[model samples]
Target chain A: MSDDARDEETVTVAHGGGTGRTRDFLEDSVVPRFGGDADGLAVGLDALDDGAVHEVGDRSVVVTTDSHVVSPLSFPGGDIGRLAVSGTVNDLAVMGATEPLSLTCSLVVEEGVSVGLLEDVLDSMQAACEAAGCAVTTGDTKVMGSGDVDGVVINTTGVGVLPQGAHVPDAGLSPGDKLVVSGPVGDHGITLLAEREGFDIEGDLTSDVAPVNDLVAAALDAGTVTAMTDPTRGGLSTALNEMARKADVGALVDETAVPVRDSVAATGELLGIDPFDVANEGTVVFGVDAATADAVVDALRATPLGAEAAVVGEAVTEHTGRVVLDTGFGRRYLSEPEGEQLPRIC
Target chain B: MSDDARDEETVTVAHGGGTGRTRDFLEDSVVPRFGGDADGLAVGLDALDDGAVHEVGDRSVVVTTDSHVVSPLSFPGGDIGRLAVSGTVNDLAVMGATEPLSLTCSLVVEEGVSVGLLEDVLDSMQAACEAAGCAVTTGDTKVMGSGDVDGVVINTTGVGVLPQGAHVPDAGLSPGDKLVVSGPVGDHGITLLAEREGFDIEGDLTSDVAPVNDLVAAALDAGTVTAMTDPTRGGLSTALNEMARKADVGALVDETAVPVRDSVAATGELLGIDPFDVANEGTVVFGVDAATADAVVDALRATPLGAEAAVVGEAVTEHTGRVVLDTGFGRRYLSEPEGEQLPRIC
Candidate 1:
């Protein structure tokens, strides 16, 4: 490309929109230099899984990192601190590491932010760590000049251990596998969008931001979890699509079976956003054995966080690498989200 | 504090200056909630050391995190990518983990950043990883709306391994320990300050930014490393004071012995900055047993990166928790840096 064209090649929100665009950027620029995987790593960048599982003395150590720049810092139900901790912990949980060994937090705060607000955020983070049975063992802090950053951006890295043969990848799904979702979807994204845009919806539209490792542990104890991933940036549609493409299998979802809170659905309708395409922090989609599907659902439903658990889909051989959504009246393909639906919704 | 007074409490650049103000913030706001150490951690947040050492079975796993937000992106000798990787890697190295097992990177880019520039940065990061003999196993990328963030901010977390009793802490110095500096001081801070301020110096002023794990490993092999810390943010003065205060000993320094490049010395004089009070990214200050101090210096000098290695000081019991400088004519106390010598020097 010429200089003019290259200069015009600026990044858009879509590049980080957790869709095909994001995947394209990674595969083109990052994967080539960094490579997909390295020696002694069970799940490296190539898999694009929730975490990287490093092999050490016949044991698997999972490591993952995420940077959170959610707007407003404080939301209706949760704030950036809570979101930062839960996002990392949930990533580890989905990678079959239910209990994180430790976590490292790095905070980049813009000048002029109130210390009181920072304290509140730190308190929320500590509370979340306690809830997840983990702690922030080490952290780094940096301050930038005014206007260099908005509020604060937090980056967290988590480390955990998984049994040798128990390593789970998002691409481990089979054609006969059943899929289940732990509780309602879209609550986190819809609530944040409403709160940011000042929708003033009637019902309570609190964010479902939480760490779901406890619920995942319960599910694992009940049945076999073949593949798992948390619906985050691109929501359920993008997550299911990724699993299908990576596993080379098709996903058939019963639209009516996917749980959605009444308030979230109404708010999403008001905003013209599909709940399935919105983000969720405290939800997980698990691919399980057909024989243990109901058992997993029962196990999830037994917990408070998973009270709304349901069997939403199944892996199939037909329509490989596609997600088929059955809307009761008809069936259509669920395409991955294209661009930024709501940026900084994490 | 009242609401108005609390609201007036805003974070300034000094809070992140790596000086007394930074120490106060960590102790008052962060350390209280996060605590100083935990059960399995050998050195936790409270010590304010280089990294956290988590005891896993009979071995120690060192983990550290750092976020880089240097302006101009590309500088004389290095860029943010190399700085981010080297910063995290050195943290682990100073904690007695010379070989990093893996690293995780998180990038937060503002809209309008050029893709080519990003590719260049990633290439630099890969090169730094290769130099340090490590690889990035996993990473995340997020883009914020324009005006929400500056050009780009990179956060990296490194994990490494050490033996059961080989963990090093910045506070492990004793009364009779000797201090060794690997190379010249203030190269990184002075070079960036001059570059950012558009100063045309006569001599070459390249940043001494590098991964000095090999140099540190060599020093360790030649002597008993009682304590170690990198003079990153507040230069040699702050690091020595921290060691003295934490270990309850006094540091006596020979002012003429510390190494300072001629270009750096001239630039520091022009900028009204003291070389001892500025940052150095590619250097290390070691507290070693007095018996093997010469051997440690010899080992460090044998390495290409540590030709200027010198024994600059020693720990003494006379004036506990202080640093005294002997100028060959008179002796005076060297106070810790107050605040914000040069913002974003890293």
Candidate 2:
């Protein structure tokens, strides 16, 4: 076996540290496993989206599950509970599901964890659930010894029902398909990093963690949306690359068109990381067919969550499996992400 | 707020460290939170089973989600993938749901993880899904930098349908209800600890991480079951106490009647932990009405998974909210679990 393969057999602490290597592992190891069955049992391996969907009883259901192990538990942008609820709900919403109901929450809380804090987190979760139009139906709480855990780690699973005939065009991208982002990216990652590093940024720089179902619904209703994805862990770059590879197409993005918050850009510069590969909890990239691109953009703008929607690029047939950026200098080259940039932003 | 409240706000590593103090948190803090409407939501705070069931369109659905952050992702009994799938499915089954349709899985993998190893885990997960008669409908994969995690953590959410009027009792313990355990307890916890400690109880101890739906179905078919639970974290003692408290009744268990593998008992003694509080992966405690107790035991015995099933205890009105053990020496007293013994064994 190759050294790389040998290394895969053993697990290290760095994998959970939420750094760049995490992205690389997903691209190299995890993605290819689902080889081309976009609607099969293991179809999620093909699309780098927030969650997966399954067709049951003539209805497609969107299902997503997430676990939060953030050390501080509470952060500037959000806490573990908020992240847990928002992250999973967003996954379902991005898939165009409505009336998301019921969440199964399993909490692994350390012994001696304060009851007040747990109640506070639960309150936050309840609020999040209500905001997302869901309820916490069942949950399991296990308390370990004081040294057994950091604080509390929450794992949540959610189920949402997709509208009938809501066939989310998974890979209909052509050379002229427009790439539209619902809003700015990288705020969640940057905010998390800032909180961890004890750095302060202007404009609150809070996590842009919100449910995006309305934005997705508006976009879909406007016309034919070729594809949709939440730019989460690996940010826009990873998301675009996965889309291109899955659709067997190429994408040409103008770096200038992608929205980047000033705080996030500055934070990225200071940390020597590229914001393109950072994580965004609430951002989504929608690939729209050229004929209805304008209508889709307008519809997205109508939603409060999609006020900043902008067309960033076009899908291409050339340079298949490649994502190219049209730099202002007029150079054309592959925009391959250098490394796993943000490991644990999610 | 006092110092105790302040302490509650922060979670220390000890909570997840698999130790005694962890038990204290569950008994003292987490258990008291289930105080609300009981009948409106089946299996709500009252029973404290894996997931909650809600009435939906003439069908009751059981939903469950869990995260697998067990250190040494790959263990003798199972890996993170198998654990993730089985844990979620068992949660649904314990709620008396049948034929779980689909499971949604999300992975947070660290960078530098081997693709081949991930494939193994995925394959194992697929096999597990098949065993449980469920499909892997959706999933997400996120790779973080190596430092952010140990290797990979998996979060899975499952959805299942419960037959109409199949009142799967969460907690309705009345005096004279018989407590029937499906099989041996503490094997999974002892096996995990033994492996983690580099001891050699290998062959004799393997995690009993099988889906318990079939066993549950048998018990339900046998007759009316007053209460049912899977003795997982905090083991039998913790599970019984919770049931007793919820039912406003007490339990008297015969120590000698409780089934325990000799190997697990030896390991527990060596580690200074009680077998009662040790974690269990695949054991169910069924409280059946006294009239149908013999029939339930007979039904369980006919099944391969419950060959060793036995009546371990009975519920009582005296000493409500407490569990007592009837020792062979003819003494009966409260049997409270001391602390979080063997934390995070689940």
By summed lDDT, the worst window of 10 consecutive residues in model 1 chain B runs over B34-43
- How many clashes (backbone N, Cα, C below 3 Å) per candidate? 2, 49
Q: Lowest-scoring 10 consecutive residues by lDDT in candidate 2 chain B? A: B17-26
True-structure lDDT of candidate 1: 0.90
For candidate 1, lDDT tens digit of each residue in A21-118?
Answer: 88988898887887655668888888889988888765678899999999879898899999999999999999989988889888899989988888
Q: Residues B1-346, candidate 1, lDDT per residue (tens digit)?
A: 7867766799989988889887888888888887755678787788788988888777788889999988879889999999999999999999999999889989899999998889889999999999998888888989999999999899999988777768889988898899999999989988989998887377499888899999999999999999999999999989888889989999999989999998888988999988899888899999999999999999999999899999999999988999999989999998877979688877
Residue-level error in angstroms, candidate 2, position B125: 4.2
Provide the TM-score of chain B versus the true chain B for each model in turn: 0.98, 0.89
In model 2, the Cα lDDT at residue B129 comes to 75
lDDT of each: 0.90, 0.71
Model 1 segments more than 4 A misplaced: A1-7, B1-4
Best by DockQ: 1
